[model samples]
Target chain A: MNGRCVITVGDLGEFGIVARIAGRLPQGRTVLLGPGDDAALVDAPDGRVVVTTDLLLENRHFRLDWSSAYDIGRKAAAQNLADVVAMGAVPTGVVVGLGLPATTAAGWLDDLADGFRDECDLVGASVVGGDTTRCDLVVIGVTALGDLGGRAPVTRSGARPGDVVAVAGRLGHAAAGLALLQAGRAGGAGPGDPAPAELETLVDAHRRPRPPYPCGVQAAELGATAMLDVSDGLLQDLGHIAEAGGVGVALDLSAFTVPEELETAARLLGADPLDWVLTGGEDHALAATFPGGVRLPPAWTEIGRVTEGEGVEAGDRTSEHRGWDHFRT
Target chain B: MNGRCVITVGDLGEFGIVARIAGRLPQGRTVLLGPGDDAALVDAPDGRVVVTTDLLLENRHFRLDWSSAYDIGRKAAAQNLADVVAMGAVPTGVVVGLGLPATTAAGWLDDLADGFRDECDLVGASVVGGDTTRCDLVVIGVTALGDLGGRAPVTRSGARPGDVVAVAGRLGHAAAGLALLQAGRAGGAGPGDPAPAELETLVDAHRRPRPPYPCGVQAAELGATAMLDVSDGLLQDLGHIAEAGGVGVALDLSAFTVPEELETAARLLGADPLDWVLTGGEDHALAATFPGGVRLPPAWTEIGRVTEGEGVEAGDRTSEHRGWDHFRT
Candidate 1:
């Protein structure tokens, strides 16, 4: 017989588990109705709502051994919330659909809910409602909603020639962290040999991405043209802006200030740091374009210039990598 | 070599598949910005929006051999849409996150999209945006958004002791259909012997639930005190209202008009017809409580009454079954 008195989800039943999760979450001001209802009611003050959805499956999107349940929860919420902000809207609430194996521990789910609540709190949003079901593996589906605040949506097609391209959050940090973790898993390091503080920071970045939530609204208020979350690599995501707007984006690679940790990790791993910055995905940075002559705020860094052509180029070389494609890549 | 060339999602790629699906879906009036952007912008004419989510796994929630992809898509959208209407709101749009195996045929996805579109078209809603990813099994997450149209939401906690309970739409049909399918799978029936029309109707009900979409609004407009969609068994869902309102629900077994198909199926299988009507789930029938003096419309059938105590009772006996629990049952 097992000595530990661990409770599984099957033991608690659906309603019991839902009650535990709901009891812990604090409702936001915009939530008219929270959990324990047929549906949640969220305030859409501006008469329009921006919506986005994402799916993360176990092993494909994340591994349980590599990231904790809390980490997965944060990452899942972060990615969808980033999408809402990318539309130049203020996020109001999120509804999640979680499918987990019946054998999953009850504590693991509680930690997951805590991660969702904490991450939502960072942006003044809340977990308004969700549905949980039994499945063979852990699959998370998050849909985030936001209010546009009476402003015209900044879409990808609005970018044009003579615009300046910029970004508002970290790049390559998650990728470098991922590399470190992969190497560590390959017998490079164990619990006995702790990673350096800087390297550990990278690993943490991969585990839970902290997107610049307010920067999206700020960019729109500043009259930014096209915008999107840099979920794909820098060059490939820029290519979307170019393709949508019928223009070209030329990047100046020298403008990027590679963090010391990325450089050091790259040196040790025999990899190109520039590649991580240019082609890595999952950082969820805000990439946008503005009129060429506009004085940009400090939060955004100019990375490239829009040109009268097609596709994306970086420092006289055309990029071939198009970032992550779930099926093909 | 294979006899026929089949285009899988892996061969078509993510962008290609998205473009194909997007090309097929026509934008609704409420969609300010449709797919191909970071997020979709939906017009919420009222100040509040109703949202709900549900997850459907391949084997657990449905079996591919028993139901078509189109049937699964309709069922997924219907369940969430029903939740919205249960709150007295009209569904505006839906965002889906789908995880499919790399080997899934492109045509199957197209049919699924068609089903979603057709179902949305029924209620003047549309598929605004979605995310697709690769997984070992097919998992679908659907989040539906609705506009309350300035009406106060009808919650489950509003039932009073003197209130009368009523139901709208089909009940026990889906459950009866499921039992038939399970029997057929266990070698009871084959293609050589076609099922009667009534049995086929039950099977179809299980595959695609026909939730009375407009009845929810009708009930609210007619002054429903408490309401919920019966996705779980009638007794189980009524128990939720009873518990929430701090009152007991006493259902009359004689009040129900069991469909002939249910009776025929029950007779053939040696099962109780009353059990199907009382405990069957997934029909998405709307159950509501109203003032005892009020006359319910023709769409609603009075079935029970609110009492001073807690829990649900049918005729003289209290219910023992608690319907479908994702983790436990």
Candidate 2:
């Protein structure tokens, strides 16, 4: 760190920066032509590709002051990869669009690329190609492509009455972490900080969401119908399925046993843990509705049932709006 | 326009804005499942997908004050589509990631979508999916997918000595138009305004580049050794070919006959038209090197030839740097 040249992106120039970024990426078998080309060729073995895009603005989607470049990269990759998983597909490759300030340190980009590569490696995917440009703020746009592997894509419009609604990963943790950070109680915590285990877990989840990626494919194999990643809170994301499928979802709150850690953390903050469970988003959890009487996959925990009508209900509380509205804030 | 709602994007919210934007796009045969789902399914018939991505930041790439939202959308689509074409493939679909201020007019997004659709229509492609987020400045990220139609991708490394260099689109027009805009001479010119016809043509070209999309496939069919779109000026872009092919490119100055209008416009501005022709970029013209004996396509004009050694030369004047460097500014 002391002897090496730490040049800025401006000093390296666009082509130079691109060359370095491309050099560090490990191209897998899927990449026929990698960077330094007009376009990249990736084998889509399934004959059809599942494509999804996500835009992450600097302060809106992430805050550099709170999260390191590595965390930001992981978060960006996780969210986009989860989108492909939600479609019941195997992740293939991702093309990224990165906008950085000219004065940004080149090492920051290196760490970001490592983050992308590491996250992609978790799903057996690869970073194929990307475009880099200059912007005042860091803007990351990821377009993830996936292969269905002969399975039908599970869309949000297939849930029906009598279907069991289930979730495959933790919820509300990210929101709780965000709350802790917003309150300035978590970001500065160090290795020996006296933060509770629950608070620490929530904060880490907020920084890097570990979505249950495999469960998406497993759910599809087990005949799950309507599906989506829990991005805009559980109830809010569930509402999308309800509205798309023209059905209602009535969640059994008792099925969700609030973790003792979360309860303690909630009590510490004087906030309702139930609200976080119902409305906290960005967990990247897979929520699906399966036909009743089918053997449930081990990864899934039944939490609700599809009902006749519209909107979502938790216990006796039914509402049409229970999610995050990006523009409202 | 009077009593009806003129809601901003903030008023409509993310889902509402997405619904409105998705409602207006014409999904073609390629899109199996379009925008309302977590991801879109587009057919990749050739079992391979040619992919590329680009980021366009406001002010850095396009200025909202100078171009309409519609024009901005068209420009973004054109650049990405040109990348696919440059790879010797036909475009299939595009997924856009748009970052906008919440206060942006909902109608602006509608026009942007229309512009995207209009440009896609020109290339027989569709808008498959997108993600939108709130940001201080408008940033557009487009990932374009293309089908190779069973042909090997034309890469930059295929150019060799004894190849005839040719181009299939206009040169220097966009740069000339940018100059006019920068001089504050074109935007305010009305129908009866005193702006020269040539200046108007340049400004229009700058606003919307019409790449010779088909010529890419045509060049591939003709067994051209190498091909790329002229994105960073003839000299600057050709340098990519030279570096990649391990060869030199020599341009014939006499081969270029400056358009009378461009010359007149250049004189009016006291600028040398030759400099614009030599250093201008973003015309998105197909630049290729065909075998010397191959019958030159009618769409292409012979401009130069591949030479031994390295770097590019034009009438004994040669420089490694002659194009836009994003970090330089």
DockQ of each: 0.90, 0.85
Which tens-of-lDDT digit does each residue in B112-227 have in candidate 1?
Answer: 99989988988999999999988888899999999989899999999999899999999999998898887772233644344566588888999999999999899899889999
Please report the candidate that would top DockQ against the real structure.
1
Question: In lDDT terms, which candidate is top?
Answer: 1
For each prediction in turn, the share of the native Cα contacts (below 8 Å between chains A and B) that it retains comes to: 0.94, 0.91
Per-candidate TM-scores read 0.97, 0.96
Off by over 4 Å in 1: A1-3, A185-195, B1-3, B185-188, B191-194
Interface Cα RMSD for all candidates? 0.7, 0.9
List candidate 2 stretches off by more than 4 Å.
A1-5, A187-194, B1-5, B187-194
lDDT score, candidate 1: 0.88
- Give candidate 1's total backbone clashes: 0
